[model samples]
Target: MASLELKIEAKAKQLGLGPIGIIKPQAMEGYIHRLFERMLRVPNGEKLHRGFLELFDVRQAYPWAKSIVVTYADNSIYYLPNVARKHFGKFFLTDNRYNINAPARKMIASLTAFMEGLGIRTSWNEHPGVTGLRWAAQEAGLGIIRRNNFFFSRRAGSYVSLTGWVTDTDMELRSTHKEEPCPEDCSLCIEACPTGSLSAPFTMNMATCISCANSYTDSTAIDDHKLNVLTGSWLYGCDNCQDACPFNQITGYSTEIDFPGLMELDHYLYPEIIADLDYEDINDFIRPKFFYIKSESLWRWRLNAINVLINTGSSDCTRILKKLLKDPFEIVRRRAQNALELLGS
Candidate 1:
C-alpha cells in the first residue's frame, strides 16, 4: 500500500507546493508563554491583540486536529510598482490566498480535496486561535524564524506568504530538528524598524507596528501618533526589517513561479490614488485587493494618505492634502486638515 503521507507530499510537489512539513498541533516550548507575556507587558496590548487569548487552548480550537500542516506561497513573480511598494505589503499584493484562480489557491484546494478523498478532514489556519507560523515552521523544520518575527524557508525569503491547516490524518513528520538562531551580535531588523516596535530580538509590539497601525475596526479611533514618521510614511506595510535582513538576499524571487493578475493591481495602489478613492472604487478596486481596512472604514485609506503626505512635507504632498480637506468622511477631512497645517500649507 502506498503511504498516504508520501502521496500527499507528491501531490503538493506536483502543484508547485513543496517544503511541506507536519508536526504535532502545538507550538514550541515556552513560545506561547513568552509571546503572551511580551504582549501583555506592553501598554494597551490586550486592546490591540484581543483575539490573541484564544491561542491558549489548542484543543478547543482544533478538536479534531491530529497534525499541523505548514506551507508557504512564494511572492516573487508579481510585479509591483515602486510607488505601490512604498505603501503596500508585498505579501498582500502577491498573496494567492483569496484569489481562486491563483496557483497557491489551487494548491490549497487540491491538498484539501486529496485529504478528504481518504475520509480525512482539514481546517484552515486559525492564526488567532493558534500561534504564529514561525513557531510552526520551526517545529516542522521547514523554515527558521528571523529576529524580526518573519518566517524564511530555504527556498524563499521573508516575502513568502504562509498558509496551512490542521488535518485529522496522521501525516509523517518532515523534520524533527531546528535550525540555528540568528547571529547574537546582529540587530539589523531591530535597528531598521522605524516604529521601534521591534525593540528587542524576536519580539514585536503590535500596537505601534507600522503594519498593525494600518488595520482598523469600528472602534478604532484616530491617534496623535499617526502623524509620526515612524508609522505615517508607509500606509499599509513596512518592509524595513525584511529588506535589512541578510538572509532575504535569496536570488530567485523575480524569476520564480508567476503570480497571475499581480501587474494589474499597479493601477490603484498608489498613495495619491488611494486617498481619493470613492465608494465605488473602494468596493471595486481597493477592498478586493488590499482589504486590511474594513469596507465601511474606507476613511482609513484617506487618513493613511494624509499621514504619508505629512511625512513627505513636499509642496506636492501639501497640494494633495489641500484637495483632501473636502473628504466626505469627517475623520478623513479632519486628518487632512491637520496634515496640511503640519506641512505649512
Candidate 2:
C-alpha cells in the first residue's frame, strides 16, 4: 500500500505542479515579531501589516490545520510577449489566479481535489506574504530563502509560483536545502535594485519598492523625483532584483507550457496605448487583467504609461505625450505636461 505522502506527490506531478512538500504548521514568531517592529517604524505599517498577523499562525485561521502542503510552478517555462516582458514583472505575467481556466489555476484545483480524496480536511490561503510562505517553504525544506527575499528551488530559481493548503494530516519530512542561501556574499540583487529599497540583506522597504509603489498608488501621490527616475520604463511592475540573480539566469523556456490570457494582454499594455485608454476601455479591457489600480483611478495607469513614454524618450513618444496633454483627468494632463517638459518639447 502506498503512503499518503507518496500518493500526494504523484497527484501533484500528474496535475503538472511538479512536486509536493508537506510540513508542520506553526506560528512564525520571528516573522511576526519583525512585522510588528516594522509597523512601528514605517508609514501605514499598522494598516498594512496588521491584517497578516493572523496568517502567520495556521491554527489561528484553521484550528484543525496541523500541516501545510506546498507546491510550486516554475514560471520560466512560459514565453511572454516582448511588450509584456518589458512592461510587467514575470510573476504577474505568469499569474493565473484571476483566470479560472488557466493551467496554473487548474493545477491547484486538480491537486486540491486529489488531496481531498485522501480523506484529509483542507484549507487554502490566497496571498503569498500574509501566509509567511518564505518561512514556511524554508522550514518545509522545499527551497532556500535567498538574500533577495525570494525562495529558490535547486532547479527553478526564484521564478516559481507558490501554492499551498493547510490540513489536519502531516506527511513525511525531508529537507532539500540546495545551494548556499547567499553564495559568495552576493549583493548583486541589492545593488541591482533601482530604488535602494533593499535596505539590508533579506529586508526591503515596502514604501520605496517599485512593485509596492505601482499598486493602488495614484499618480498625484508619487512625490519622489528619484523614485520616478529610478523606476524608468517599468509601467506596471519591476523585477530588477530577481533579474540580477545568477540562479535566475537560466534559459530554454518551455514551448509546450502556455499562459492562457497572457499573450492577448499585449494589446492593452503598450505604454502608448494604455496612456490613452478611456473609462470604458480601462474598465472593460484593462481592469479585469492587471487590476492593481482600482476603478476610477485612470490617472494612475495613465501616469504609469506617461512616465514610461518619458523615460523611453522617442520622437513618437513625444507626439503621444503631446496628445496626452489634452486628457480629461487633470492629473493625467499635468503628468503629460511634465513629460513633455522633461523631453524639452
Candidate 3:
C-alpha cells in the first residue's frame, strides 16, 4: 500500500489541486508559543482557548487528514454586479458556492462523518481565531506566513482557509525549522484597511472592523453615519483590504478547495438580497455562518450599505430603501428608516 503522504498527494493531484504539503506535529511548538504570547498581551487570553485546543486533534476525526495542508488563492476575484460592468470589464462573480452548494455542505459533513468513523469528534464554538489554524498549517509543513500576516503558500497567495484534521497515521516530511518572520518592508494588508482597524502590525482590532461589525446584532446607539457606509456590501461579507494585496492580485486561480468563490452569495452579493431579507429569511440562511451579522453586525452593515448607496448618489436603490423601512430585522429596519431621514435631511 502507498504511504499516507503519497495517498493524500495523489488524491489532491487527481483532483487538480493547486499546491499542498505536510508539516510534522513536533515542529509547531514555537509558533504556538509566540501566538500564546500575543494572546497574553491581548485583553482576554481565555477566550482563545477553543481556538488553541483546535490545533491538536481535539477530536481525532480523520487521522489521515492530520497533516495541516491547504489550497491557496480562493477568493481573489469577484464581480460587482452594479459597478463591475462599468469599471471591470469581463469580470464576473466567483462561482465558488456552486461547487460546494449541496456538495460543500455534504463535503463538510462527509469529512466530519469520516472523522467519526475514525473515532474523532468535532465541536462548534464561538468565533475561533485564525492563528491556531495558521500555526498548525505551518507546523504541518504546508506554507509560511508572509509580510501581510496571512498565510503565503506559493500557489494560493493568501486566499486559503487554514483547515485542520487528525489521523492515526503520521505523515512523512523533510523536517525543517519554522519560517522566519515576514520581510520588514511588506505592509500591504495594513495599508489596505479602510477603517484603520489594524492597530499595530498583525494585530486586528475586531471592534472597529466592517466584517466584525457587520456580523453584530445589536444596533443600540451605533453611529448612523458609519452604518450607512456599510450597506454597500451586497451579499454576506467584505474583502476590501485583501483585494488590495500585491500577492493576492498575482495569485492564480485556486483549484483545490472550491467552496468560497469570489462572489459567493454569502459573501459578496450584497445590495439586492440583503435589501429583501427579513428576520426569518436571515435566520434560516444568513445566520448559520453569519451569526455575527444576525446580532448587531447586520444592523451596522445595513446602515453602512445605505450610507454607501446615498453617498454614491445611486438612486436605483431608493425603492429598496423605502421597503427596507418595514424590514423584520429591527436593526435593519430602524437603520433604514434613519438613513431615509438622513437622505431627506
Candidate 3: 10-residue stretch with minimal lDDT:
84-93
Local distance difference test scores for all models: 0.70, 0.75, 0.49
Better of 2 and 3 by lDDT: 2
**Model 2 accuracy (lDDT, Cα):** 0.75
Tens-digit lDDT string for candidate 2 (1-345)? 988888888888877784677777653566677667667655676876676687688887788877878778777788777777788888877776666766878888887888888898887755553267766777777887787888888767888888888888866554677666577667999999988877566677777888877765744337566777777878877889888988887633445666777666678878888876676888887777666777867678877777677677644788788887888888778877877776688
| RMSD per model, one decimal | 2.5, 2.6, 6.2
Which sections of candidate 1 miss by over 4 Å?
A: 26-29, 125-131, 176-180, 217-221, 251-253, 256-258
Query: Which clashing pairs does model 2 show?
Result: none
Per candidate, the number of residue pairs that clash is 0, 0, 42
Candidate 2 residues lying further than 4 Å off, grouped into runs, are 33-48, 128-130, 218-221, 251-256
Clashing pairs in 1: none
Where does the lowest 10-residue lDDT sum fall in candidate 2? Answer: 215-224
TM-score of each: 0.90, 0.90, 0.67
TM-score between model 3 and native: 0.67
- Residue range 140-246, candidate 3, lDDT tens digits: 45676654456655455566544444444445543343445555776767776656665456565444555545444434325535533543442333465556566
The sequence of per-residue lDDT tens digits that candidate 1 reaches over residues 58-145 is 5567887777777776676555667777777777777675577677888888888887897778777523324456677677788777
Please give the distance, in angstroms, between residue 60's alpha carbon in candidate 2 and its true position after superposition.
1.2
- Between candidates 1 and 3, the TM-score winner: 1
